[model samples]
Target: MKVLLYAEATRLISKSGIGTAYRHQIEALSRVGVDFTQDWEDVYDIAHVNTVGPGAKNVVRHCKNKGIPVIWHVHTTPEDIKNSFVFSNFYAKLSRRSLTRKYAQADHLIFPTQYTESVIRRHGVKVPGTVISNGVDTQIFRQNLCKAREFRERFSLNGPIVLGVGFPFKRKGIQDFVEVASKMKDVTFIWFGAKILALLPKDIRRILRDPPQNMIFPGFIPQEELIGAYSAADIFFFPSYEENEGIVVLEALSCECPVVVRDIPVYKGWLENGVNCLKGRSNDEFEQIIRTLLKDRDLSEKIATNGRMVALERDLSVIGDSLLKTYEAVLGRCRS
Candidate 1:
């Protein structure tokens, strides 16, 4: 079946999880022999809209009017939007109402996590939806010793490295990351992600300007280099307050890097504390987890190994099959 994969503002979200998800979806759908098009004008059997912007809403409306099946992908919610960037919190309430209206136009909905689906339901989005992860390309994110060594040398990094990857936003737990780094002055703390200087909040901007001695903000490295960073790091620490689904955690797992993430609902079934990953409830807990992982090589290796297995289960190939099935099911309902 032909599918129109639509996501407004692709360039704007290119460095974001949404953009990465779109790219991975396109690759996976193609591999599974699903004919798809990004062009709005192209004739297609279904519309898989990923964003809820003006253009996206128009597409959803157009598809409904044309009797075409529309699958809306839920990548954001009001709960996750607050404190994400400048003015995000201010606009979050309105976004919820807007999102509810837009999602209502879909024939079916897709959520990256069950927790996200629950959030939407709480916000009064009653549309039928299912949970599906934004899978990672294991080959691209897996360990690369050569690249890792080169990356460490290029950045002059020494000693154990704790890393995080995401945009420099307050909701991403940037302040907490900095606080953790200050306590662990012996280890190198590198954050690889975009830094939108103009849009940063005052407190975040101040912290960026006068970062801790051990903290390194290598803003926006290439994907290959990012993969290397994951391989080089002894531990991947993500203290984000929220996420629809933390794709970077999966990528770090693919690289066999032991991950320590905030104990959030989104990662309920995805990450198991003390099994595939370590979950921290606060900055103190995060620091303690990092220290434990640093001192215990066997535990780190065991977690990394198990994490890789988890990553494999959510590989692009597996996700593609799930997407195909979901599409067929949606179409069947439409016909009925």
Candidate 2:
């Protein structure tokens, strides 16, 4: 069956998680051998809308009116929108209202994680939803010695390197990351992301100006370079307060980099603490975990091996099969 993969604001979100997620959908669909198109006017049997912009609302309406099944991928919820930009929290209520109305128009909903599904339900979304991982490309994101060396040489990263991905935002626990890095002057902390400087709040802008000597903000780097960063990092420290499902975490796991994340609800069922990854409640705990991982190579290797297995389970091929099944089921119900 043919499918329409649609996402609005492609250029604007090209550097964001939502953009990465949409690309993953394309990869997953291709692996499953599904015929799909991004052309808005292209005739298709099903529509998988990945964004909630005004353009997407019109697309959903058009699809529903034509009796075509619409799968609305819930990548953004009001809960995770706060602390992203100036007055981000102030716009959350409006975002909720808009999101709920658009989501209600879909024939079905797709969430990147079960936690995302639960949150959308709480926001008054009555539509049936399914949880599918954003998935990772194990082949591309896996560890590579050549790339690792390149990353270190390019960035001049010395000693044990700690890496963090995603834009610096308060909700992402950027403040906490800075504080943690400040306390650990011996280990180099590198954050790879690019955010619009003017859109940032005063506090975030202020901190970015005078970050500790050990900290490096390389802005955004190419995907090839990012793979190297993952390979070279001793630990992937993600202190984000919330996430639907972190694509970067999956990439780190695939690279067999031991991950330390905040004890957030989104990772409840998966990301077992001390097994595949470490979980910390605060900056102090995060620092302690990083220190332990640095000293205990055995423990680091154990978790790294386990984390790779977890990533394998969410590989693009596996995600492709699951997505194909879901698409067929939705179409089958429509036929009946």
Candidate 3:
């Protein structure tokens, strides 16, 4: 079938989750020889608009006018706005509410994870959407990465490394990470994303105690460098208070890195608790959980194997098929 993907927000700074997701999905479809177009030159049977904000709304409306089935990929909600330091509160709220309406009216509403689906159902909208989890490039984050050890040494680490990515601040649960890291003095913690740096001024940064001696601050690195970083990380410690569904988690899991995620339905169910990840509710919980994984090499390796297997099963190739199925189903529904 013919499809036109309007990835309007792909221009954001590198490592931006939404932009990365859009770009990767577009590439995934192309790799598999899906007959899709980015521009509007050819008439498309379906128009998948990635994102929920104003930009996507316009594209959805245009497709609706042309009688093409529109797929609205709702990645975030109003709660995300409250929790996001990367995007200003005013903009997120405005975008969330409007996007909700646009999504509710679209031919199909698709979410990256079941957690997002569950929350939106409570908002009193009867939208027909499926929980299609986002996928990762398995080749880059796989257990077979040749540079794993070399990359670790390059990052100046021979010890267990705790990697934290995405925006910083209360929303991302970095504050909790700081509090937790201060107690467990063994593993090294590192952060990325320029937006995280921009969140805290020099004065605010000074107050936070310097992390463990094992810790290192290797400023923001480009997306291309993330494979090396993932290869080196001993654990992907994500304390995000609200992640629509962390793409990084998939990336890390693909690299066979065990994850310690907060008590969120998406990660909790999507990933087998204690099998692929350690699920927790608070800073103390996460700290203890990390401690368990760190001490148990057998457990860590087992979980890592499970994580890579999960990534292989849920690779972009698989996720793309689900997306197309939704598109075809929606198209048939529209035709009838």
In order, what lDDT does every prediction score?
0.91, 0.92, 0.75
Model 1 ranges with Cα > 4 A deviation: none
Question: Where is the poorest 10-residue window by lDDT in model 3?
Answer: 201-210
Q: What lDDT tens digits, residue by residue, belong to model 3 across residues 181-281?
A: 77777777877655454656453255234645655556567755677777777788888878888888888898888888887666756688877887889
Q: Which stretches of candidate 2 lie over 4 Å from their true place?
A: none
lDDT tens per residue, model 1, 1-336: 899999999999899999999999998898799999998778999999988788897888788788899999999788888997789898997887888877877889999989989988987878888888999998788999998999899999879999999988888999999999999989999988888988889999898888999999878999988888999999999999989988999999999999999998988977899999999998999999999999999999999999999999989999999999999999999999
List TM-score per model, in order.
Answer: 0.99, 0.98, 0.89
lDDT (Cα, 0-100) at 248 in candidate 1: 93
Total colliding residue pairs, candidate 3:
2
Ranked candidates (lDDT, high to low) = 2, 1, 3
For candidate 3, the per-residue lDDT at 139 reads 72
Query: Where in model 3 is the C-alpha error above 4 Å?
Result: 86-96, 144-146, 196-213
Cα deviation of 281, candidate 3, in Å: 2.2
For model 2, how many clashes?
0
Q: How many clashes show up per model?
A: 0, 0, 2
